[model samples]
Target: MSITQHQTEAGSGMKPVGKAKARFGTGRSEFVVVAVLYAVAIFLTVGTATMNVQGKSAPGPQFFPILVCIVLYLAATLLAIQILRKPNVPDNTVHPGHGQFSADMLHDLGHLGKEEDAAYDAAPSQTPGKTWKTYSDWRTIGLLVGGVMAFVLLLEALGWILSAAALFWLVAYALGSRRPIFDIGVGLLFSSIIQLAFGAALGLSLPPGFVGGIF
Candidate 1:
C-alpha cells in the first residue's frame, strides 16, 4: 500500500477507540457512587433528627443518633464536592501499559477496558513499612471484658462503690497502668463520683448491697 493510504487507514481505526474511552470512563462511575452515598446520608440525617425521645434528661436516646447523622451528612457532602472538582481524563491515557488488553484490542472490541482492573493495577503496594507493627492484644480486650463482667456479677452482692472501684482498677491495669497506689486512689475517686452523680443527684437507685445503710 502507498504511504498516504496506510496513514488514512490507521487514523480511521483510532476513531472508534477514542469514542469507546469517552463512553465508560472512571469520572462517570465515581460521580454515580458519590451521588448515591450523599443521598443515603441526607435521608438518614432528616429521618433521625425528627424522631422524638421520651426521656427527662440533657441527653436523651435521640441525641447521639442525631449527632452521628449530622456528621455523616457533612462528610458525604465533602466527598461529593471533591469528586466533582477532579478532572476527567481518559482511563487508558492516565497509566499506559496497565490495561488487560492493548490499544488494538480495545479498538477492535469497541469498548473501554474494565476500569476497575486498571485502577487496581495502578494502586500502590500495601506492603508494611518501618512504621507498621503487629499486635497480640487479646489480653487487653479480655481484661476489659472480665472487669466489666465482674462488676455486673458483684454489683448486687458488693454494692456499687466496691464493684465499680474494683472494675476501675482492673481496667486501668489492663490499659498498662503500673502504679498500684495511684491506681487504687483513682479507682476509689471514680467510683465515688459515679455514686454521687447517678445515685444521689440523678436519683437513679444503684444497688446498695451490704453498705445500704451507710449511704
Candidate 2:
C-alpha cells in the first residue's frame, strides 16, 4: 500500500486487516506450503533410511534421497523463520454509537470515535470492496491441480521425462509464461538430466516411455 492510501484509510478510522505482510513476505497459505514441504522432507528421510545399500564403501541409493530431503528441510526452515518473525497486531473492535451523541457520550473516550466509525460504515465506497478471496488466482490453482493429476495418471505411460516436462510446462503456463517452446525445452532438459543422474549415479530406474530411446 502507498503512503497516501494508508494515511487516507487511517484518517477514515479504519484499521487495515493484514499488516504482517511487510515482515512475512507472504500470506498464511505460503506458510502452509512450507509446512507441507517440511513434512514431505521428513517422510522422505524416513523412507530413505530403509533403502538397502549395494556396498558399505560407496554411497548408497539413500544418498540422493537423503540429499533431497536435506534441501527441503533447509528451505522449509528458512520459510518458517521468515513467517515467524512477522509481528501481528491484534484487531480492535469498532463499536458504533448513535450520530446524535456528542463527543461526551457514556464511553470514557467519548463518542467521537464511535461517530466516525458509524459514518464510515454508512458511506458508500467509491471503489468495489476486495477481500483475500478476490485477490486469489483460482485459474493458477486449478491449472496446478490439473497438472498434478495429469502427471500422476500419465507418469507410467509418458515416462519420467515426458510426464515431468509436461508438468513443468503446465506450471509455467499457469504462472503466466507464454513461451511454450522455451518452457518445454527447459523442462525436458531438466527432466532428462534428473533421470540420467539418478539412473546412472545410483542405479535408480525411472519409467521409460516410447521416447525413452533418445536418453
Candidate 3:
C-alpha cells in the first residue's frame, strides 16, 4: 500500500487484523482466581458470623475473619474493576489434535515454541517485577500447604500458641524472610498478641491443649 494509504488507515482508527488489544493485566486468569477467592471470603464471613457467641458484644470471635473478608472484598472489587476497564486478551494456547500425536509434528511444534519463547524472554515486559509470580513457585507453594496442614493437626493438640507461632514462622520464611531466629521471635510475638487480643481483651477462648493451664 502507498504511504498515503497507510496514513489514511492510521487516521481512520483501524486496528491490525489478528492482533488482540493489550490488556491491563497479563491475563484474565488472575481476575478469575481473585473473583473465586472473593466469593469464598464472603461465604466465610457470613457463615462464620452465624455461629453462636453467647453474651459477646460487637467485634467478638467473628470480628477478625469478617475484617479479613472485608479486605478481600475491597481488593477483589478493585481488581475486577481494573480488569474490566482493560481490553480482553485472547488465549493463544495450542492443544494437541485428536488421536495420538505424531513425533515429527511434535518436533516441529517444539522448535517453533522455543523460538517464540526466546523472543518473549528477550522482550522486556511492561510491568517487570511488579507482580507476585515467584510467590506461586513450587517451593513456596509446598511450604504454604505444609504449614496449613501442620497448623490444622497441631491446633488442638499442640495448642494455638505453638501451632500459630510455627505457622507464622513457616510462612514468613517461605516468603523469603532471611533471619530464622528473628522470624521465630516475631512469630511467637504475633501469636502472643493474637492470644492477648482474643483471650484477654475480647474474652474469647482459644484452644490451650497441653498448655491449657498456662494460657
Candidate 4:
C-alpha cells in the first residue's frame, strides 16, 4: 500500500485502541483524569466522615485521611476547572502524516507502536532536541512508587524514622537532588517532624520497631 494509506490506517488504528480521544488530546485527558480523581476523593472524604470511630479521647482513624482527602479534592477540582476552561491549544505546526509517510515517519510510527512507547512522538529522535518535545517526568513517578513500596515494606521492621527518612531521600533524589549530605539531612529533618506530629501530637502509634525502647 501507499505511504499515505499506511499512515491513515495507523492513525485510525490508534484511535480506538486507547481511552484517549483525538478531540480530548493530552491536556484534556489530564483534566478529565484529575476531575475523576477529585470526584473519588470527595466520595472518600464524605464517606470517612460518616464512619463511626468513637473510641478514646482522640480523633478517629479516619480523621487525617478525611482531611487529606478534602485538600486533595479541592486542589484537583480547581486544577481541573482551570484546565477545562483554558483548554491547551496543541501546536498544529507539525502534522504527523503530512508529506506522505517518509521512511522517517514509518520508523517513528514503528517506535510509537511499541508497548513502551511514549504517549506523543513529536518527531523522530534524530530531529534536533527541542524544549517542548518532552513528556511528564516518569522517572520522578517511578521513584515515588518505589519509595512508597519500600516505606510500606520496611516501616514495621526499620521503624517510622528510618523508613520515612529513606522515603524522603528517594523522593528528593528523584526530584533531582544530587548532594548526599543535604538530601540526608533534609530527609532526617522531615522524618523527625512527621514522627513528632503523628506520635507526639496526634497520639498515634507509629512503628517504633528496633528503636521502641529509646522513643
Candidate 5:
C-alpha cells in the first residue's frame, strides 16, 4: 500500500484485516476464570454433600460449607454475566464492538484469538519488566497471598475476629480500597459477625485468643 493509502486507513481507524490491538481488557481470560470458579463451587458442593455427618449437632458440619458454596455459585454467575455483557474492545479509536451484542462482536473474539495464536503461541510479551503476558498484577496478588498467610499464622493466636479482620482489610486494600480506617472497621464488623455466626448459630466454639480471654 502507498503511504497515502496507509495514512487514510490510519485516519479512518479501520485495519485492513479487521484485527486491532486490544485497548480495554478482553474477557477470554475472565471467562476461563469464571469456569474454574464454577467448577470449584461444584466440587465443594459435592464434597459437602458426601461429608460424614457424624454428629447430632444442628446444621451439621456441612452448614458453613453449604453457605460458602452458595456464595461461590452466586459470585461465579455474576462474573460470567458481566463478561458476556461486556463487548470486545479490540480498538478504542473507533469504538468497535462497543454496541449491544452483534455478529461483529463475536468476530472480534475470533479475530483476537487468531492474532493471539499467531503472536503469543510461542512466547509471552518481551517487554522490559514483564515476565509473562498472559497475566500480571503481581503486587495485588502478593498482597492477597500475604494476607492469607497472615490469617493462617495468626488465627490461633489472635482469634478469628482479629485474624479474619486482617485478611479482610488486606483484601480490601488489594482490591483498591484506600480508606484504611473505614476498611478496617468494616473488616472488623464482618469478622465479628462471622465469629458470632460460628459460635451462636452453628454451636462451634472457635479459639477465644488473648483478647477474648482477657475480657
Candidate 6:
C-alpha cells in the first residue's frame, strides 16, 4: 500500500475511547441515580401535597420537596452536560479509604497500642483493587446499605435516639472506626443533639419508644 493510503487505513481502524466524564467524588451512575430519586421524590411529594390552611401565606407541603428537586435536577443536568462534553480520564488517585469522619476521629484520639496502630496504619495505603476487581468497594457499599436497612427496621422499636445512635455507630464501625467507645459516645451525643434540635426546638415529634419519659 502507498504511504498515504496506509496512513488513511490505520486512521480509519483506530477507534476513539468514549469514556464518560464525571465529578471527582461522584460518578455518572451516582448522579443519574440521585437525579432519578429526586424526581421520584418530587412526584411523590406532589401526589400527597396540601397547602397549609392555618395561614394564608404558608408554603404548600410540596414546596420544599419541589425546591429540593429543582436544585437536584439542576445539579444532575449540569453533571450530565459536563460528562457529555468532556471524556473521562482514568483516575489512579480514586482509591478507597476509611470514611472521612471515622479517619478524623482516629486522628483526634491519638495513637492506640502498637499492634492496633500497625493494623490501622495499613488501611490508608490499602486500595480496594488489592482484593476486589474494581476500584469501588462493594463491601463498604453493602455495609452502608445494610446499616441503613437495619436503622429503618429498628427505628420504630428502638426510637429515634437509639436507632439513630446505632445507625451512626454502625456506619462509623463499618468505615473502620478503631475506637468503639468514642464511636458510641459520639453517636449517642450526635443523636441526642438531633433529637433536641428537631423534637424540642422544631416541635417535630420523634418516636420515643420505651424511653418516652426520659427524652
Q: Write the per-residue lDDT of candidate 5 for residues 22-57, one digit (tens) a residue.
A: 654564467777887899999999999898777688
**Per-residue lDDT of model 3, residues 15-65, tens digit only:** 888955554565555677677878888798878878787775776777787
State the lDDT of candidate 2 residue by residue for 1-215, as single tens digits: 79999999989999757744344333344677787998899899878887667776446677778789989999998887776775332223333333333333335555356557666677636323422112458889999999999999999888999999999999999999999999999999999999998788877788888777665
Estimate, for each residue in 1-215, the C-alpha lDDT of model 4 and write its tens digit.
69998899898885545544456555575676686677779788778878767566566567688788978877897887788787765443222333333334545667324332332354355443333242567888888888899899999998888888888888888888888788888888987787788877667777887888664
Candidate-wise lDDT, in order: 0.68, 0.75, 0.73, 0.70, 0.74, 0.65
Cα lDDT tens digits, model 6, 41-155, are 5675565465343433335334445676677667767766776556444333222343323333445675334565566456755544343223667888898899999999988
TM-score for all models, in order of appearance: 0.40, 0.63, 0.61, 0.60, 0.60, 0.52
Better model by lDDT: candidate 2 vs candidate 5? 2
Q: Name the better of 2 and 4 by lDDT.
A: 2
CA RMSD of all predictions: 14.4, 13.5, 12.0, 11.3, 11.6, 11.6
Q: Runs in model 3 with CA error above 4 Å?
A: 1-26, 56-59, 84-136, 213-215
Query: Where's the lowest-lDDT run of ten residues in candidate 3?
Result: 126-135
Among residues 3 or more apart in sequence or in different chains, the pairs in candidate 2 whose N, CA or C atoms overlap within 3 Å are none
Counting clashing residue pairs in each candidate, in order, gives: 0, 0, 0, 0, 0, 0
Which 10 successive residues of model 6 have the least lDDT summed?
92-101
Best by lDDT: 2
Sorted on lDDT, best first, the list reads 2, 5, 3, 4, 1, 6
Error of 5 at 177 (Å): 2.5
* Residue 60 error, candidate 3, Å: 3.4
Lowest lDDT block of 10, candidate 5: 89-98
* Cα-lDDT of candidate 6: 0.65
Misplaced by over 4 Å in model 6 are 1-27, 40-44, 51-135, 213-215
TM-score of 2: 0.63
Residue-level lDDT of model 1, residues 64-142, one tens digit each, is 5566777777776777777666644433432233344544456577654567446646663532222212244899989
